[model samples]
Target chain A: MRKLTLPTVLLFIALALTTLSNAQDNIWTPETHMKVKRIGGTAISPDGEYVAYVVTSPVMEGEKSEYLSQIWVAAADGSFNLQYTRGEKSNNSPAFSPDGKQLAFISQRAEKPQVYMMRLMGGEPEHWVSPIPTSSL
Target chain B: MGWSYGGYMTSFVVTRTDRFRAASMGAGLPNLVSMVTTTDISDYLVAHMGGEFWDDYDTYEKHSAIYHFKNVVTPTQVIHGQNDVRVPFTQGQEFYEALKRKGVDTEMIVYPRTPHGPREPKFLMDVSERIAVWFEKYLEE
Candidate 1:
């Protein structure tokens, strides 16, 4: 029978401690979960060359956390991707026009959500419709 | 197209305009009246609708996309999580059935064991790919 040495025992203990530390570092916590970006609300362009989608992530304000969603466009062939909207407010529900020249979506830049349209080629989003106020509904 | 509140907006917008060639509604509530009754967040919906469904049926019906289904001309694709209690799977069904009855092009895709949003990576990819295919089929110039 072989006897274990003191240095070998210490080495085993050191390895176990390192493994435990690594496990703690990789642990999944609620804060980690909140930081994950969520992708959703996909809209395909009329020509099927591009796809519009929403990406939402948690925005931390002091101790409070809120989600901010923005629109993103990606080519069907995976050649390019770009963020379509920016800022703190949320923008979502993208719809491509029949001609695929314009994209419409809902934005909460004001007190209520309203439809906004923008040319796919370029330019700022034009506020298109405000169907009904939330208070009225 | 969108999911949850986005889905509701997509469903509502299609009923109001025909400018869009195609739309994909995910976990959307087309019928606010039925949504209040079946959704897990009934109180939230009722509050948003301004009152209980029984107390203000007219308001609920007016806001519901189902009431305006006759005005919808755009081909729509409905997607839902089968086990979704948030919006409920029937919401998608109602929209799909209305489109079918109206002789409009429509299809419904239900993901089994999914909740309000797809958690499985494969299901998520399927949704993105399907939406692209659906639009191509209807929007080809």
Candidate 2:
């Protein structure tokens, strides 16, 4: 090891201080928190070929911030991944049929959250079940 | 399966239908009456439940999944955080016990030091992998 010179030591200190200051400048903020995407509600295909899950992202509109959750499907072998749902409303609770050809989930597109079924081969999601009216509850 | 509201949906849907071969419920509320009293957000649950559970006992019972457990035939895997205050761990326990007693295949896993959901990356991955395995086991006919 070489003996450290005063000038070299001072140069190292300066670099360390600069890095610390830069880190402080990049401290976490509310905006930073909002940018994070969360994944949940995972379901596996019957054949274990694909996994369906929900990705929740924060949307900032004017001064209001809202979360938008959409279903996503990915191959279990990590071959391909794709978003299974879109639009402004939130969709969640993905479940696969025993046949592995269809996916069932809850969507908030209607007045209330309803169950939807979509084919794996491709096509639009079908609104399947609507909850009982609140009046009955 | 799902967490929080999604968990609630899983429990509720399983009671209404037997389409799914297997399901994993994460921090789900199966009993609205117990959930309203035990959850941290009692007011929110009460508002959604239509009123105080005591005031509308019939309505609460009718809406709760536990009341319709006899109709559930699908095997369910229940996962919950021991420290969860939002849905309460007892919800998962109750559902699991009910299914087990009914001879409907069921299992419950409790994670210590966790809240409404698993926050650690390992716990999250474990949940995903375990659920996948559960579906595979039951879906295989």
Candidate 3:
């Protein structure tokens, strides 16, 4: 055992106090809400080549605060990660087609929410419509 | 098709199509007007629904599953948390009762002390098993 000097004891107390204060500063609060990142709604490609998920962060718009959500794509092997969609409104609920050639998701780019399909290779997402009106369902 | 919102979708879909043999609705809202009154976000619902129940009764009733229950032929399994406040337990109860009264095959599993969704391990397992059993039974037929 080593002898405890007065300065050494004081030094250990100071370090402990610093850590406690730092932890207190990191407590959850409305001000720290923006610093939090929420991740959810995962959709894996049929071929298992990529994983699509939503990442949301709080945003302050004029007088209101709302979440800004965007879809992110990641390689199955964890080699690459990138933002998949860049729309002004929130984009989420990703679903890949059975053949893995197309990705479908819901977006509000057209004022009303609609299903948009995009090729995994690249290109702008196109609105997917069925032969029958969805409103009839 | 949905969890909370999906449950609502499943409930609405059955009234429109009998193409599905079996469906499971988990914590769904069947009555939009009642939902607005009961939900914690009453003001938010009023804004989303465009107005209060009295202001736009037809719109709320038009989208509500309760009004369309007469057309549902598909067998449905309604699962809900007894303590769910967001969607409330009454929604599931009302749907189940309507199905029963109509002589449609239906079952309701209300997990005690559960909210919105089953978070406890035991309740989760119960829900999974019940779902699997319900689907398998319908598939076998």
Candidate 4:
């Protein structure tokens, strides 16, 4: 068995410290801090021109508890500010058809996630499913 | 759809690591894949689509997809991770090796230290670019 000299002990400690520092250098740091807890409605248009996503905010009980959400659209450059849906109903999961003419999304207007479709040009939404059921959604 | 097997697609763990924690996070770092077990066990899958290996005499000699790979007309590409948790890189490596041995033009990319989602943007881009190149080279031809 080899003797545990003071220098050998110090060398081991130094090596451990160096390894820890290297690990810290490689650790990930957030590029941006998003306020929203969960982000839904990640949709890329068929033409790949626009991306629409929703930012949801919770509601408090006895104070109307409105399901609030904002539908945001941005160019491939992540610009072009627009809110397609801004209302009491929480909106999410914007889907575009292959042609990119039509858009579909989910809403919590009826205390459930009901599929709603609206034309890209401009029009009222048409409800496809009634009384949508989702457990953890 | 026949209503059966309560343990089919209905099964999924929100976090994969929680399900197979024993595998350890980096047992296979660059690869993270696991196909949920089909509800039906051995007998059902084999009878329906045939097994990977067969016991019949003539069928053994028959050119098939899994074994008699030479019969494959479709151009194939194999991808594996240095550390794959579920399906494991070995499986992909073996498939690619077999195709190579048969003198088939196949490509493979073994990503290092990544899981299913590939959180890193560059890695994701690499995967997409690799797939695009493969499709462009094979499909266009």
lDDT of 2 by residue, A1-137 (tens): 99999999999999999999999888765445555789999999999999999999766666434578999999999999999999989899999999999999988888877889999868999989767364643
B-chain TM-score for every candidate: 0.96, 0.96, 0.96, 0.52
Best by lDDT: 1
**How far off is residue A81 in model 1, in Å?**
30
Which of the two, 1 or 3, has more lDDT? 1
For each candidate, what TM-score against the reference? Answer: 0.51, 0.51, 0.51, 0.34
Task: TM-score for candidate 3, please give it.
Answer: 0.51
- Candidate 3 regions exceeding 4 Å error are A1-137
Candidate 3's DockQ is 0.01
**Is model 1 an incorrect, acceptable, medium or high docking prediction?**
incorrect
Instruction: Point out the worst 10-residue segment of candidate 3 chain A by lDDT.
Output: A128-137
What C-alpha lDDT values do all the predictions have?
Answer: 0.88, 0.87, 0.85, 0.52
Interface RMSD of each: 10.7, 10.9, 14.7, 13.7
Worst lDDT 10-window in candidate 2 chain A: A27-36
The sequence of per-residue lDDT tens digits that candidate 1 reaches over residues B24-136 is 99999999988887988888877777789898888988888999888999999999999999989999999999999999989999999899997654565568778888999
TM-score of predicted chain A against the true chain A, for each candidate: 0.78, 0.80, 0.80, 0.59
